[model samples]
Target: MKKLTSLLLAFCLTLASFAQQAFEVMTKKPTPGSTIVIEYMPRNTVLQGKKDFEATAYLLEGGLPRAVEVPLKQEGGIFRGSVKTADSTRAVFFAFAKDEIRDNNNDEGYYTALYDKKGEEVPGAHAALASAFGNFGGIWGLKRNQQKGAELNKKEFANTASQKKFATEYASYLSQSKDAADQDALRKLLTERLKNEKISEADLTQTRFFYQNALKDKAMADSVAALLKSRYPAAAQQTELVAQWNKAKTLPEREEVYQKFAAVSSPANELAKNRLEFFDQVIAGMYADSGNYEAAKKYLARIENKQARANALNSIAWKLSGEGINKQPKDAKAGLDFSKQSLALVDEEKKAMKNKPAYLTAKQYQRNLDNTHNMYADTYATLLYHKGDYEQAYAVEKAAVEGFKRKDASMNEAFTALTEKTKGAKAAQAELEKFMEEGKYTPAMKEQLQRLYIANGGTQAQWTSYISNLEEAAYNKFKAELAKQMINVPAPQFALKDLDGKEVSLASLKGKIVVVDFWATWCGPCRASFPGMQTAVNKYKNNPDVAFLFIDTWENDSNRVQKVTDFVAQNKYSFHVLYDDAKSKEGNDFVVVENFKVEGIPTKFVIDRNNNIRFKAVGFDGTADELATELTAMIDMVNAEGGDVKKGF
Candidate 1:
């Protein structure tokens, strides 16, 4: 007995040591409804040397997965946190991040299966894990693996309750799978379920989607749809309403469609309320386009959700202000009114504080509210400034700057311009100089500052030196930050057709440094980032070792190539645009983007000579010079490495 006890103790110690290497779970056999303590050791992971860390627990509860931010406390060299699993918790996937740096266990993610009293994996646990690997993983910043997810999902299909519960996810997996056998199996399963009348409404709905979208079998999909309409008329009507709304081109047609839909859909239905709000916003925009401010305001007033209404009003206000002040100058009054309404709505929301979404933490919710308020206030101030209300604009912009802590560049620029109007050129010059030294000024702000400097008797040489010093300082700071985010991941290889139909392959550019940017024509951030991208491309045009390739993905138009061509030509951007037109056997596209595991557009990857992805940048912050500097620094860093390191994945 002593010998047996000694062996078990040794085994347990080994297990504990292994677990402590990266993450340690205190509860060895964590069951549903129990709280589990997790200790994260970031000694050698991507989050190494980060002082603060955040933990997001992706929990599967009641057949639905939700992300909950779990607070962590630093204990010596590790961070510790605990999460309470609900009785229905099937699995939990943990993701750790410090701002943009994430440690998703190198994309495999850190997760564990929940158990029952009998120590067996709970029902739907595999399905939840599958979702963590496939569908929900990308949304949570974890790499998606559809094949692995589908394999896991296959285990739960035998359980009828689980099948019904996860019908949508299962159908999604079936649609994404490129295997002919998998497709055939899904069709067979659907036929069997339909013949036996064993499928639920959810299952039937997903089945129709699979046939229509994935298999492209319109006749079969229509047959299933008709059956669904006969069985679940309410769900069918909701779907048809959306289809009709999408088909409607004119405002009157949309209004008629909404009236028909409203007559059938109940006010109690959340979907109905969302559709009504959407229709109201669309109609309001149409009226505004036609210069009918009264009709627009009437439609906007019908929107029930305060935040949504405020957002719609702010969007319209910003659009009108941009057009009227810069181009037309006649819609300024209408924009000001809309801006006031938006500000009032935002103020009311701040007072109420009862519309916080469930997904955000209290702190996050407050931060979002503050951001929204500041954004609307900036718009209001801008409109006021454009309308020649200098004093009021200064006051509103001052409050916004204070609220933003002087971090927002555009707001600071607006405030500086207002300061010139309200105070004097000297006061504006002083403010601009402070913002420039703090690296909180935009390119437009810099131009304004230079104008002020030249007007204030400062020499061109002095201004040039001042700008150069600031640029050098900013470049150094950005380089240091980029150095910390450096990684050595293997770049996925591809041979794509460029705009000229000439094939370009990663293997062909073996000795050159490559910058691959994933974007779509519809992405605002992507379009906004192009100026900076153009700057970087121009800077490297003479460098034979550097190459930039912009791959357009996720576009659904039939004339996608022509649209992309026209956009690039119209913008005068000299970019070698590649079309990501590879499709799956199921006819689903965005294949290269999927392979790269990119969750969003405007994601750029810097590859070294050996094709290792040294850095990945996501999103654009609307700073052209900063983006150019950052990309230049990344390329220089990779070039300095000389491609000597071993390849990694």
Candidate 2:
């Protein structure tokens, strides 16, 4: 019994030792500006812990610090890596990352434990939490920490952590602190570091950090800007000028800032005058939005350049002829005056721009001037109808549509058709451009987007590549919103066969909300959406008031029906299937494609009980749960609405 007890005690000690095993780090700045070796030991999760881990050596190369990954090997008990420091290196910082380590108890995701110069963990709020740092205790392990193992004594580690190689603590504080005085002190500390420092690109960026954070503390920002100007005069001036422009309340203050900016950036302040004229154009819009047409016109009159004045007037007139600011009713008569004035200026300016220097007279300026004239003409026609002058309105509106169509055939054919439909100009010039300022994409713009998509084989990457990062996200969001505005149009009726060879019509599916999914047998993304769609289907499956039609369109096979049947059976998908055989082999002239303009496959349409297409989605965004939620929302929307005949997408 005593022998067993002794063995049990030994086992308990071993277990206790294993439980305490955690990461350790030790650093030595061996030979100045030569090499710094870092030794680490991490906790073992399985019978064998991680084989190796990555140590990111934040070493200074030519006074600029950059992170370079150094792979460490485990031998005996510790992980070690010796990396060469760059020339003129002053300090070093180290961190463990992308390690193949896992905890059996928790997988809180990737948490970085930052360490200072002394090899002590510089703990953050996340590190203090038991949920995150439970595994990161200390360097001791089941193996007695030996050579190649970190020789960093606890006393040395504790003392050196206060002074770091990097300005991480200062950077963190500068970003987070709201107190102006505290921020000022930190900036002063950082500035002292910059005095003798030969500035790198990173250092230059950090030096300009004050202006980046200037939106919060304008007074401190001004002080910092003053300091920055002493060092970087041009950059500081430009930054301060923009700040002043954004902050200016009165028009004169804005003009003053604009003049100063223009003087420095453009010789002889030519850009300033043009910018001021543009400013007047924008301010006029603000007045119109406030329902003060007279005030808006007064602002427009401030624009000195004839073309700029006309551009402003054209914008104001468009607002007056249609739904005014915030979709409020417009004043057609008031709009007509501005429209007439703008058209006259447009013609005059066209001749004037030709004589001006090429730089001043850009191609875009000409296009904008011409587009403004076209838009103003619509406003003029709209005003005539409002005053009961239908004959003149019709003649003017028809002429405008024909003029643009002659130049660009793809310039929204719907708008041209709508224009021609006006019985003498009973005022229905509700073109696509009237709503969107820049969103009113012309033929060239639309063709550019289309050709890019076609080149990429109908993938979203092409669309993303065409726009900037910020614009890509915003444009996609805008496009998604546009797709949702279905105009309550009637769902185009179609007769198609099901898997069992029974024919079905949209007419037959009356008194139910029908979900029409245009998919193909081979479309991978379409197939990926099925699981999530199935979850939604299961929810509404028992509800007799809802029906789903999984239309197999744009199928690669000549025998699409057979392929669809095989796929659906193989997956055991409980979906209401329909076959839409393409009239041609290229799959260009299918009924769904031809009638509803389904250019891309995996298009979805939600129809209400009244047979109106209420919602449409063009692609299968990869998220089953999100798709289910959207489907549920669409189903609920139609279900909640009382059965009434509404406007028809």
Model 1: per-residue lDDT, tens digit, 1-649? 9567546743543353235578877666689999978889899988899876778887876444666788898878878888998898888878888756888876657777787888866887877888767666775587766666766676655467766766665666667777897688677767766785756777788788888877778889999999999987877888888899999999889988878888878888886788889999999988888888888889888899988899989888887777322234446788888988888888887777788654455555676788888889888888887788889989998998988888777888888888988999899988887777666777777887888888989899999998788767766665676676688988889999999999999989989999999998989999999999999999999999999999999887777889999999999999999988657434246778888878788999998899879888888975787788778889988988733333333
* Candidate 1 residue 448 C-alpha distance from true site, Å: 1.5
| lDDT for predicted candidate 1 compared with the true structure | 0.80
lDDT (C-alpha, whole model) for all candidates: 0.80, 0.56
| Residue-by-residue lDDT tens digits, candidate 2, 205-299 | 45456434422444545555556567656555666777787788775586577567655654344644565566667767867767777777886
Q: What's the TM-score of every candidate structure?
A: 0.83, 0.30
lDDT of 2: 0.56
Clashes of each: 1, 2
Q: By summed lDDT, which 10 consecutive residues of candidate 2 come out lowest?
A: 140-149
Highest-scoring model, lDDT: 1
